[model samples]
Target chain A: LAKTTQPISMDSYEGQEVNITCSHNNIATNDYITWYQQFPSQGPRFIIQGYKTKVTNEVASLFIPADRKSSTLSLPRVSLSDTAVYYCLVAGGSYIPTFGRGTSLIVHP
Target chain B: GAGVSQSPRYKVAKRGQDVALRCDPISGHVSLFWYQQALGQGPEFLTYFQNEAQLDKSGLPSDRFFAERPEGSVSTLKIQRTQQEDSAVYLCASSPPLAGASNEQFFGPGTRLTVL
Candidate 1:
């Protein structure tokens, strides 16, 4: 399993865009980057995933550079309700997913 | 269609008592996992089951913790002689068979256990 490093917390204002970056220097060739959002007392929900390049979904977008050692999760037009903890994981092939101390995003009014 | 579900959303156990937590995974999900989350910390993997087989249990903290998935659908995690350190939220997640790919895991609300 590859270890990931991300910001402990971030602050954003409503209607503003937010980007959280994760670093996985030991990422493997077969690994895929995934991001999850977790609300208070709730399970982590899948936000976006990508292997390389960019992948966009209805909720968020994921950008992966060519090296695949780092990935970014971009959330457009943040809202107060969007405040939550975000987790980034690198897993694939036979690797089991692991969650690190996620980045806590606080969307201020 | 229902997602994963767990019973007894909250449990308060006295020290030295035994407790059991139940999890009902999403229908047709082939992979089931158990995780323990302490307050102010990220979740930690506990065990995993592929169908009726327990593929990995190396994450289990101690021998006192046991988990079983008999029919490959519902699972039960039992803890014997609960201690204060056992107080945490137990999360259950299920995912479809990936066939060597990475799949999104659907999680339950988790069982909050407080040992007093």
Candidate 2:
């Protein structure tokens, strides 16, 4: 399992872009960076996933550096309703995926 | 037929009591998983099943925890002798588990168990 580290919390104003970065120094070659968002009392929802470079979806975008040691999740045009906990998981190998401590992004109006 | 569903959205149990949390994954999903999440912490994997066959259960905290997927569509996680520390949300997720592919797992709303 690749251990990941991310900020404990972050703040963003509505309409602004927020980027949360996660570091996984021991990430494997086949590992892909995936992000999930969790609101209180609910299970985490898939946000975006990427193997390399850039990947964008209707909800968010994922940017992976050339080294793959770290990746960033960029939420465009943040809103107060976007306040939630974000998790970054490096998934690969036959090992079951594990979610580590995630970053809490509070989008303020 | 719809998204994943879990029964008994909230469960309150006494110490040493037994509890069962159920999960209904999406139709024809080949992979099923159980997870336990403590307050203010990320969820931890508990066990996994592939097409009704138990695969990895090393994540189960102890013998008190048991899970089964008899029909490959629904799964149940039973915890015996519940302890106060067992108070947490129990989550279920499912995926296609396609070989040579990294599949996305859809998660259910989870059963919140409060061991009083």
Candidate 3:
């Protein structure tokens, strides 16, 4: 499993764009970058996933650089409800998904 | 369509007692996973099952932890001799066949266990 490093926490205001970056220097060739959001008293929900370059969905966008050493989760027009802990995982092939401590994002009104 | 479901949303157990948690994956999902999440921490993998076969149990904390998916639909996690450290939320997730390791997982609300 590839170890990921991210900020402990981040703060943003309503309508602001939030970007959280994760570093996985040991990422394997087949590993895909996946992000998940977890709220209080709830299970983690999948946000977005990408193998390289960029992938966008209705909720968020995943940006993976050419080297694939790092990835960023970009949230547009953040709202108070977006406050949650975000986890980054690199998994593929036979490797099981491993979650790190995650970055807690607090969206202020 | 229904998603993953877990029973016993909350449980309080005394130390040294045994406890069981159950999970129902989405219909036709072939991959089931069990995870443990502590307060203010990300979930940790406990085990994985492919259909009726137990594929990985390496993440289980100790011998006290056991899990099974006998019929390839419903799964159960059993913890014997629970300790205070065992207090955490047990989550279950499932993925469709051919989803592999990187696919998105549908998660249940989870069972919160508090061991006194």
Candidate 4:
């Protein structure tokens, strides 16, 4: 399992675009980037995932550079409800995934 | 279909007491996982079970913590002699068959355990 590093906290206004970046310099060949969002008292919800380049979904977008050293999660038109702790995980096929202290994004109205 | 579900949304135990947390995975799911989340921290993997077989428990904090998934469906995590540090949220997650490690994992609302 590769270790992940992300900002401790970020603040964004409603209707703005928020990008959270994660760094995993030791990412392996089979490692994939996944993002999850957790609100207070709720389980973390899957947001987006990507292996390389960009992957977009109805909720968010994930961008991975060619080096795979880092990844970014983009949330567009954010609302106050989007305020939550976002986790970036790098995992491979073996099923062992580790989570670090995530980035807490505060979306203010 | 219903997503994962957990029992005892909140539990408060005196120090040294035992507590059991339950998790019900989605129907027909093949993988179940237990995680511990401290306040302001992300969920930490505690154990994993592929069906009824507990494949990995290396993340379990100590022998006091035990988990079992019998019949490959409902799973239970038991904590013995709970300490203040054990006061955290226990999360249960399940993934569909053939889902990759990075695949979406359905999570339950979680069991909030408070050890006083």
After superposing candidate 3, which stretches have Cα over 4 Å from the reference?
none
Q: Model 2: per-residue lDDT, tens digit, B1-116?
A: 77999999999999999999999999888999899999999999999899889989999999999999998888999999999999999999998757221568799999999998
**Candidate 3 per-residue C-alpha lDDT over B3-45 given as tens digits, one digit per residue, 9 for 90 to 100:** 9999899999999999999999999999999999999889999
**Model 3 misses residue A7 by how many Å?**
0.6
Off by over 4 Å in 2: B97-101
Residues forming the 10-long window of minimal summed lDDT in candidate 3 chain A: A91-100
Task: Encode model 4's per-residue lDDT on B1-116: one tens digit a residue.
Answer: 57899999999999999999999999999999999999988899999999999999998999999999989999999999999999999999999997557778989999999999
Q: Give per-residue CA lDDT, model 4, range A1-109, as digits (tens).
A: 7999999999999999999999999998998898999999999899988899999999999999999999999999999999999999998765877789999999888
Query: Which runs of model 4 end up more than 4 angstroms from their true locations?
Result: none
Docking class of 3: medium
TM-score of 4: 0.97
Candidate 4 residue A78 Cα shift, in angstroms, is: 0.6
Which ten contiguous residues of candidate 2 chain A have the minimum total lDDT?
A92-101
lDDT by residue (A13-95, candidate 1, tens digit) is 99999999999999988888989999988888888889999999999999999999999999999999999999999888654
Candidate with best lDDT:
3
In order, candidate lDDTs are 0.91, 0.90, 0.94, 0.92
Q: How accurate is candidate 2 locally (lDDT)?
A: 0.90
DockQ each: 0.67, 0.61, 0.78, 0.79
